[model samples]
Target chain A: MFQIIKNEWRFLVRSRLLIAISIAFVSILLLSIFLGNYQTQKQEQTYQKATEHLRQQWVSIDAMNPHSAAHYGTYVFKPANLLSNLDEGVNSVTGNVLRVEGHVQNEIVHSEASQMQAVSRFGKLKSALLLQYIVPLLLIFLAFNTISSEKQSGRLKLLVLQGAKPLEIILSKTLSVWLYGVLLLIFVVVVYGILNFQNLTAEILTRTGLFFLSYALYYFIISGLTVFLSARWQNATLALTSMLGIWILWTIFLPNILMSSAEKWYPLPSRNEFQSAMTEDRSKGLDGHNPSDERGIALEEKVLKEYGVDSLSQLPINFDGMRMQADEEYGNSVWDKHYGSNRNILHQQKKSFQLGGIINPFIALQNTSMGFMASDNLHHQDFLLQVENYRRVFIKMLNDKQTFGGSKTGNWGWKIDNAFFKSVPDFEHRPTQISVVLSNYIMDVSLLILWSIVVIALIFFGTKKIKIV
Target chain B: MIQTIELTKKYGDFTALDKLNLSIKEGEIFGLLGANGAGKSTAINMLLGFLNPDSGKVQINDIDATKNAKDARKIIGYIPENVNLYPYLSGVENLDYFCRLAGLKYSKTELQDFLASCGLQSEANDQKVSAYSKGMRQKVGIAIAYAKKAKVYLLDEPASGLDPLASKELSILLKKLASEGATILMASHDIFRVREVCNRIGILKSGILVKELYAKDVSANELETLYLKFMQN
Candidate 1:
């Protein structure tokens, strides 16, 4: 086995194709790292500018009603992760900015894909794209000719006669290709580290490093399978064609089918239906202006009777304040029912996406990479939840101002001071850590490990029984 | 010493090797003489433990070839009909790899000396197999056998593409190996070369070895006539 590796290395050093390929591949990896860093820097600068402009708008608000400010609302967009330039993931398809307001929770809008002339389903020409698809195929091209060419030349028989075990030969060939993959992955990761020097926290570094290891295992499985097929098949062309066919099926056609099917199985209702449902539920629940809403009128009569007052003016606390509190509770229930269900629908969509493991490991890898980056559907849901929490706080504060600022039920002249407005907290978005993100993608990690075991088994015992004659 | 008893191989309904019996003495150059599809290569392949015969058994120096193929294979060096090697590797590198694979670790000088002994020139030793002629490649194949240091040598059409001089050199090498106590079994259609080098010849017809003749007892034309009779019958 060692001799085989030695021979392979000697041959590799002399082969211009292998050397040129490694050089070209490594250069491309470095170029991508530079491009990714530059692109992220560009995006962060634009985001910083946008955030400053929004803050300026926040400071210049007119002394209108507190509820009116709630209606106008503010927006907080999630910033892109530092490593996003490496993967670029579903970021292009999902929205970045979320709009928060009172009495209504709005869906995020202004996705990068929507603004484009045409959406790219395959995503941008990024490093992860090459690492996932092109690099492994290059490994296959390197390994598929390893054994069949030897057999065809009668060197295989010569080696066998010299007491070399078949399994040893297979291992040596597999190791050669595996080493190539390892070097390629390390090259990309070293570039990643050099570019993102600041964000090298332990969790981030570990996830990013595991991401490297998973991809390396993926490359090994693929190259080992290719070499095994080459040993089983008689002709070199046939082996190459078979390995390429498997590559296309796994990387291209299979993922599309699995994704589309998962989408069909876990259907998320259109935005229109969701909005209408919330509106219908909100109208029947409670309205601050209406004295005839059966539940609200009942509650009001009880409050008046208990306080022993003939009119709202006889009450100790402001009637407007009591009404605002009643309205907020009702609106909260309505959101809980409708928006909560929508969130569940998104979760269901994610669960179905996890079922793609049986057919394609690249899908598993895509999930793992995005999950660790905190750029997948789960993180998006968390962002929406945080926006909802902010909206609740913003609305509750406005209700407090209306109830306690001495405003009457129908008075339009009362106002809160700038002090109260300035006291409202701004929304702060915190992305989930890599460990928390990876926890949600355990199934994907398991699937990748499973594939590695199966391919390794095939390389070890599967070719021992091969009829070389 | 190599022996076979009623060795046979069947591929579903078509029988490739018939029930056959033969014994090859130690230190003798035994040639398997037949045309294409005559089972000469198949018989040699079975002795190398490449194929599982449907019935009967083969022994290499009293070690059952089927029951313990690894043991039998350890003592045999097979030179396949078409000599295919890694064209990217130089002659010396190829020899060194094959030698190492056989569990031998020789220094570069020793490897070069072995290559030279197989009639490869010092200039050619450094050249890749891609640049070598057909005869030179065959010499590398012979070098692989010589490097193995096995007790038996099996050659299937070993002289197919060689020029007359190269063929003569190979014949001389076979004689030297045989005289040095290496049992040699070769498959070839070259009846004249068989008569010139091999101590005995066996003709396989329709998956059966129908004729066996001593090389000195039979003249070239006489052997041809006898081969015709076996085929006609």
Candidate 2:
């Protein structure tokens, strides 16, 4: 068994093609790591400038009736994750910027995928993608002929006559292939760690470690299956073809079919329907320009009576401001009815997307990557919610000035001090933290862990009783 | 050194070897002669424990070849008919590799000297096997058997590709190995070569050993005639 392993190593050393491919794989890993870092830095700079612009706009707002300022809203954009470059996940397909204003909760817009032509369906050609798809296939290519080629050349019979146990021979061949795969991955990882020079936190370390371990198990699964097939087949060409076919099914065909089927099973509402439904519900509420409801008119009359004012001149507060507040509060309810339904639909879409986890590990990985990057549906939701929270505080501050700043009705000429403008809080968005993002994707994590376990089990138990002849 | 008791082999509905019994003592060169698909290779494979026998057992040096294959394999060296090896390696490296597999390690000089003794030129020892001729490759196989010091040598038409000179060299090598008390079992259709190297021979016909002849008691031409008669019947 040991000699078999040694011979395999020597064989690998002598194959120039294998050596060249390994080097190319390592180079690609380095290139991806560098590109990811460069892209992340560029995004961070853009975000910093956008944040400054929003702050400047807040500081320059003109003095006005407090209630009117509520209509001038703010915006918050999703921030990128530290490791977003390693695997962008669904970040490119999802929108980032969210608008928050009085009486309306806005949807996130300007998704990267929507703004570009589709080119990479396999997703950005990253190291992880190669590790998951290409590396295992390469291993199968190398090992599928391990035994069948020997048999075709008649060395298998020679080895058998020399008294090698079938199980030991199989294991030695498998171990050789497994070691090669692991070594190639480790070489890339060591290079990644050295280039990044970043502090390896427990989370980063664990996630990276899991990535390595999972891929190694995936390689083992391929090696065991290939060896079994090679031994059973009579021809070398047939063994190679059959092993490649299995690779295609597991890595490519099945994942794509599963993704599309899962999507069809849990379809999301079209964007047009989502927008129209929200608009229709909003129109049914208080129309600030033209109030058509008799009840709304009666409520205005009752408010005048309670205030003990006639002809709107004796009122202490600004009548226009009061009217605006009533309209704004009414509109808030309308926004709730419409926007709340939109959020529900999005949640449904997420549930449907997540259903793909059971059938396709690639889907699970993609979802997990998005969740970690803070660019998935949950991160978009958090951004909108934060913007809405800021809108409330900004509007309330303006309303307090109108109701209690001793301003009379119809005082359009009155002006507040610049200090008062500065006193109003500006919009500041807090991004979803790494922990929060990871928590939302616990199901994906579970699925990945499950796959790793199943593949490892297959290598041991599924192939333990394999017959060579 | 080797024995089989009513050994048989079957693949699906096709029976390759029927119930057969045979034995070869130490220091004897046994030849298994048969036409294609007549169970000569099948019998040898059973003795090597590479394939399982359906209805019998194989014992090598008193060890059951199937259940305790490793113990039996340690005492054996196999030379395949095609003389195939890792083509990227030098002749010395190939010999070193197989010898290590057989649990023996030799220094480079020791390996080169063994190759020299096996009819390989000193200059060819360090050159890649890919650049060597078929006859040169056979000499490396012989050198591997010499270096491994195997007690039992299994040769399946091992001299098929060698030239007349190389063939003569291999016959001498086999005679020397047998003289050193090594048990040799070879399967071949080369009746003349078998007569030159083997002491006793068994002729297999339609999955049965139909005749066993002592090479010393029969002329080379007579053994060929006997093999043809058995195969025809």
Which one is best on lDDT? 1
Q: Which runs in model 2 stand beyond 4 Å of their true positions?
A: A1-9, A62-68, A118-129, A157-207, A210-220, A246-253, A284-358, A373-375, A391-417, A420-431, A437-469, B11-14, B92-126, B139-149
lDDT of 2 by residue, B1-233 (tens): 87888888998888888877778889999988888888877877777666778989888887988787767877777777777777878999988877776667799999999998878999998899999988888788767777776788888887676788878888988888888898899888888999889999998877888898899999999999999888777
TM-score of 1: 0.91
Best-fitting candidate, scored by TM-score:
1
| Residues B99-134, model 1: lDDT tens digits | 877788889898888878878889999898999887
Q: Just chain B of model 2: what TM-score?
A: 0.94
Estimate the lDDT of model 1: 0.80
Candidate 2 versus the native: TM-score?
0.85
Model 1 lDDT tens row, A1-469:
8888878887878899889987888788778777777877887888788777776676566575777677778888777678676777777788878787776677788887788745454466567878888898888889888889878776777777778788888888988888888878887888788778877788778778778867877887787888898888988789899989888998889888877776687676687887888788888877865766787777778878998988777766556656656877788888888777877877777677776765677788888777776667777778778888888888788877876667766565676666677678887777677766666788888888898889879977888876657
lDDT of 2 at A396: 64
A41: Cα error in model 1, Å: 1.9
